[model samples]
Target: MTKTLTIRRPDDWHLHLRDGDMLRAVLPHTSRDFARAIIMPNLVPPVVTGDDARAYRDRIMAALPADHDFTPLMTLYLTENTDPDDVAAAHADGLIAAVKLYPAGATTNSASGVTDFTRVAPVLERMAQIGLPLCTHGEVTDPEIDIFDREAVFIDRVLDPMRRNHPGLRVVMEHITTSNAVDYVKAHDTGLAATITTHHLVINRNHILAGGIRPHYYCLPVAKRETHRLALRAAATSGDPRFFLGTDSAPHTDANKLLPCGCAGCFTAPNTLPILAEVFEQENALDRLEGFTSLNGPAFYGLPANDATLTLVRETPEIPAQIDTPEGPVTVFDPGMPLNWTV
Candidate 1:
């Protein structure tokens, strides 16, 4: 039985709209569903300063369809040499909504990210003083840290210290994928918030390796064990205002993705909401879905819930197995078969 559903429109708190060709290719897929998104800043040069962020925002705006009401909330890319005064100036001028800290070598296109937290202390201190949120790609790039435990270690080693150093600073643990991340965010819910990805809520590391190597299912802070997946579902639909939708709908070209060392990301925007609905149904937490999707994120960011409304019906929607883009055809992440819900 398909029932019509209505909820306050949701925003994607974390998104990767890669530049140039890829930007044009995937903009519509996201804009069609989300009212606004906290755009990632990891381009080749990266949006490190206010000027760079403003210019990048303009390019994203020009790329969107004229009818699209999507607002691309910009974030400054933090580097080891980032200037303290500049971060304060940008926040004061309203040039950026948040500052993203991608530890050097953490993920895709993060080669220019900060190498040591201590080196960027001045910048971090300034952001805290002016009330800017430090959104993080929570992971350790150290060769010794087990990939699966990176997020937890990051919380213990990096985030915990930074939070202690700047007690009033707002921080968002973006695209949280593990049970440990949920526990950490909940433990610090008074001062921390996390954005849960649709893929994490529905799949585990096993799904990525199921039957055969599935490139489309791989992503950074890679999916974890079955227990983590269940915990993510519980946190996502638990009606907690600290857990919200981030999608993290990162995209990569087919050539790069199918290579020997396939790039890490999942181009799931096309099926993101559908996948979330399926997960909610499995947990029988559909009744609490709206609050997680629409209410939690805005509360975390101190923004108002979207005034518009969106509907996600439970009818089976046959999305394509792959969608052709300018870069090349990209495989979509599907959970075994056609999802029994659509948005």
Candidate 2:
């Protein structure tokens, strides 16, 4: 029998399609490529309850193009006041796919995030019992901590203790940028896994500061050293089911990004899969792409693998060097770069 290479359609486990106009502008890109996505909850006010999350999910559906099969899996924003029983009920009801935990003052529109882990123990305990995965921002907000050290530091200081305290908990270390995160999750290896973003696999800190201050490349878990990037590439291409695709494809308006105090996130949803193929090809790991992009995520989340198929042809194509929006033109991570494959 001849071995066939079939492209399995993938779901984005982590994503940030902001509400209203921004959501409208970016939803099409992801919907066009992904069958489903676990949508982020860091909106302006944030989606904090089952009703809020469900309502927000409705809005995303309303914003989506009617003919597309893209399903937005909503998640509630975990705050210090989040009720555990309510959290469990929501997850059990299938109103939410997961619960997002953002340390207070972490990223865009996360002002209402949990200020201390202790404050949210009730909710965390409930989520653990209900089998609801806790997706994390994985950063320490303490200004004294080195920006590059935040993710690893959080794992050591916060995540480790929390995981140990609740052995039943399921954690997804979202947007992992350092080897520490990879090591920690693998060591824990029970119901814990991590997400590998398309940008971190391809770039390092130098890419952000080499030429100038590149606001477009700025993101939470800010890109790390070259060695870390290498580790990320290795981990992503290592054929590990523990690691999977989560574009974290957050889009910010040009004005918001170019400001002195710009927001943090990368808008890679439009070019996520195409770039993943190129990276895997470069690593000579094209064979493992499906597992990382499609299988691993759903399997970890206890969902069935996607039966639908997608195609990625080896072809040279051009992407805009930047995307022009009502706010302004923002640079794209893989923009205009020659790619070996596109989906």
The TM-score that candidate 1 achieves is 0.96
**Which pairs, if any, clash in model 1?**
none
lDDT of each: 0.86, 0.85
Candidate 2 colliding pairs: none
Candidate 2 lDDT, 1-343, residue by residue in tens: 2123467889999998888777777788899878989999988788998889888888999988988888888899999888887787788888898999999888888899977788888888887887899999999999999999999899989898998888898999999999898888778657999998989988788888897988888888899999888888898899889999998988887788889999888888878877888788778888898999889999988988878998877765456667766556656675335676666
List candidate 1 segments past 4 Å from native: none
Best by lDDT: 1
Error of 1 at 313 (Å): 1.9
What is the C-alpha lDDT profile of model 1 across 141-198, one tens digit per residue? 8999999999989989999988999888899999898888899888874768999998
TM-score of each candidate structure, all chains considered together: 0.96, 0.96
Top TM-score prediction, candidate number: 1
